[model samples]
Target: MSSSPRRPAVVRRAPGKLFVAGEYAVVDSGNPAILVAVDRYVTVTVSGSHTPGVVISSDLATHPVRRRWHEGRLTADGAQGGGRPRGGPVHVLSAVETVAGLLAERGLPVPELELSVVSTLHEDGRKFGLGSSGAVTVASVAAVAAYCGLELSRADVYRLALLATARIDPKGSGGDLAASTWGGWLLYSAPDRGFVLDLARERGIEAALRAPWPGFAVRPLPSPAGLSLQVGWTGNPASTASLVSDLHRRTWRGTASHRRFVATTTDVVHAVTGALESGDGPGLLHQIRRARLELARLDDEVGLGVFTDELRALCDAAEGAGGAAKPSGAGGGDCGIALLDAAAPQDISYVRQRWAAAGVLPLPVRVALEGIQQ
Candidate 1:
């Protein structure tokens, strides 16, 4: 009997995420964060490879990469020979290596493949900080799993993508991964880092990939009723890693102050969640204002400028229009979100005009109801 013909190309897409509330504090165990999966997406297409190795090309990359698995390692420029290419996309390599390792550990045959990635998560070479890396990893993993005839749930994709991202950078809280996996509004608490790391090392990658993630939870929540969300870009990109590193170096973690901060922020998150459930627009505004104050306090304590003048201006503009606003993620720059009292066209247009006057670019984004699509 002849072998079955190669499967056709697999295409997958995952949406980017926005941190509605709870940023730095979510790193603590069991702390809750509110995030939304945005409309922008990263799409990955995977097909059978004719060459001896995998070929990866992306719109974001200047060149394509050909890699092969040999002697328990991935070599660049195919299986035959060539030095590893430098300065390619880190997340792409991380995702491919991670899936390859997991397949090897499961005693499964590795197939030669080709991948093409396209994304709308960036504008004019500037990252929107919309969790592009996390989305790309999710899409890539989903595509590869399908290519290998492995069925993975959203949760499985999340766990695998989390591990893959951790291999690239262990500091991520996995909130982005969660949003990209499940989509929509979510209240997420990260899994225990120490436990996950130990598990990955003790058991083989297959076991780790298949293992149930402990202490992590992601639940969907309804969007606030009648509340309009808007995003404004500051035209300046902020480094989330740099902001996180600064917070860490300030000795902000594991201190009494940190505990107080978490408590205050958690209360805000709970208040927001409750408001969304109850459709309390005023309550939502109050909680967002409180959260912004709490973040400001944290910034003052750490001497890090989490809130820039532009962001503050945006917030002020929203408040002036009878809305509430705050910096979305790690702050310092990037984007800020405004929650309007109404979803009327006039209301949105007014806010947009004010945001423009404040020198912030209003981004056209909406809450994505769907997560990863294959």
Candidate 2:
């Protein structure tokens, strides 16, 4: 008899994202922030392998990694003279390890597989700070889980990706991960990092992955009617980690100024979310301006210049066209977004030209309708 048909290869796609508001503040204490998953995506494909090892490859990597499952672990042939495999792309390795750990917890054998990743989130080999890492991690985990004949819900995939990311950097707010997992427009609050880390350490990866995450919440918001968005890239990548570290060192956590910043940002987020739900174009613009001003105040108080000259010029150009603009993420550089009022729509072409003249390249990105596509 013919052998049973081999399972087809599985491919998963997750989108990059940008913060609409609440950048630095979100990491503080689960503050709510708005984010949008963009059209650009990172795709991961996985298939069973006849060879006795797993192969992981990515366009971002210099070489593919070949690993074998032995003695309850994955190890490369020459990795540390037969010790556990270490040192591939951290994000990729973390994703694989997370999948392996979960499967092991369920008494499932690690399968031999081939995995590959491709992404359109970078420009000229420089990251656009579009949350590529989070997209890749989500896609990788989804693809691997499918290859193992397991299906994961959107929420479960998100928690698994977040857990894997936490293994690498526990300080992440998970805003990007949420955008990649759920897609579209979202209001997200990060879970308590300390709690998550402790649970993972004490109860293990499986328990943490299955547990109800505390202090984490994600709500989908409808795109406001009569509102248009435009993104401009500064062509310089900003290190989110560095910006967060600087802000942490400069601003005392939970102090009066910090509390004021959080409260103001929370109010701005509430206003924006309400405007979105109500489809109030003018109200959205008003809240966007207020939010940007709050960020400016936070920058001054912390003595960290999150808004650079290019970003300021981009925002100024947008405002000159009667639109509201501000830096999208932790903005030493990277991108800024402009929200144009529909009733008084500015010429987007003219806005783009002005942004170009100000040394910012306008990006063709929109809110992705779907989150993770499998």
Candidate 3:
């Protein structure tokens, strides 16, 4: 008699996040940010099937192919070897492959299974500044681990994510993934330097900050409801590699003007963080507007000035609706989120419709609290 094939189990959870303040500045000014995880998430689950291969699915893609362990590369199309290369699936496949390899090393025979992926975040090419990639990575890693009946800590997940990301994108600050895994506002600082020496330097600096950086209180932002509209857009999805390169070049030149701008932005980010927590709507609006104005000034120098008409209009409309607005991603176009309190629900609806008409996609997102869970 033939033995019954073993079935793998499924695992799932949501990824939460929020950018309370200090986003762009965090990269340059060494300012900290106060983040929160609302309720949104990316869900993933794995299960065994009688079939002889692995199957995966999501809105970003359809099933490609299931593959046996060591048979060959498993494409998403369910074909043995005729998979066409694509964006989203490529990453997904890589993640699965890594997990499969890990399992095999642990003496678990590879099993054919179906993998399902879903996300509440708009991966429609928008950077909400809420760590979408990190969140997705965590979710994917978690699913894989669950299927293998393995337990991995948030730190483990974060490390795994960094590895996976390196294989795919290869260049990104691990801050997003750190926040996604840790789930809170943070001042993510790498070693004060870039290596062994840097580590020692960072330790010394932390000892110094232990006495000065903690007595401060960050204010709260007023209720989001006070805003008449919240509009968001996806910018051009600029490469992080390029952004970091420019930062080094400019800073090395000791650009005084850029330094001053960064200082001012740090203050603004601090103010906004306080406002969001305090639920001070008017305060939030004022700070947001100021932040955007400053961003406008630094845009060209920082190579972030290429705003699209949709972004411009959204900013204008937010002000018209008695609120504030700003781009959500790396700028050149990823996504812009706006807030307006003076407008009624109908007004907000109208603004949303208008943006949609303009070919700008809008997403309804709130702060997420639960970071990642099984």
Local distance difference test values of all predictions, in order: 0.84, 0.83, 0.57
- The regions of model 3 sitting more than 4 angstroms off are 1-8, 16-21, 27-31, 34-41, 49-57, 62-90, 93-114, 119-132, 166-170, 178-229, 234-254, 342-359
Candidate 2 C-alpha lDDT tens digits along 263-317 = 9888888899999999888888888888788888877777677788889988888
Residues 215-257, model 1: lDDT tens digits = 6889999988878889999888998878887887787778898
Specify the poorest-scoring 10-residue window by lDDT in model 3: 191-200
lDDT of 1 at 292: 87
Candidates sorted by TM-score, descending order? 1, 2, 3
Better of 2 and 3 by lDDT: 2
TM-score of each: 0.93, 0.92, 0.67
RMSD of each: 2.8, 3.1, 7.6
Clashes of each: 0, 0, 52
Q: What is the overall TM-score of model 2 with all chains considered together?
A: 0.92
- Residue pairs in collision within model 2: none
After superposition, the stretches of candidate 1 with alpha carbons farther than 4 Å from their true spots are: 1-5, 77-86
Name the lDDT value of residue 247 in candidate 2.
Answer: 72
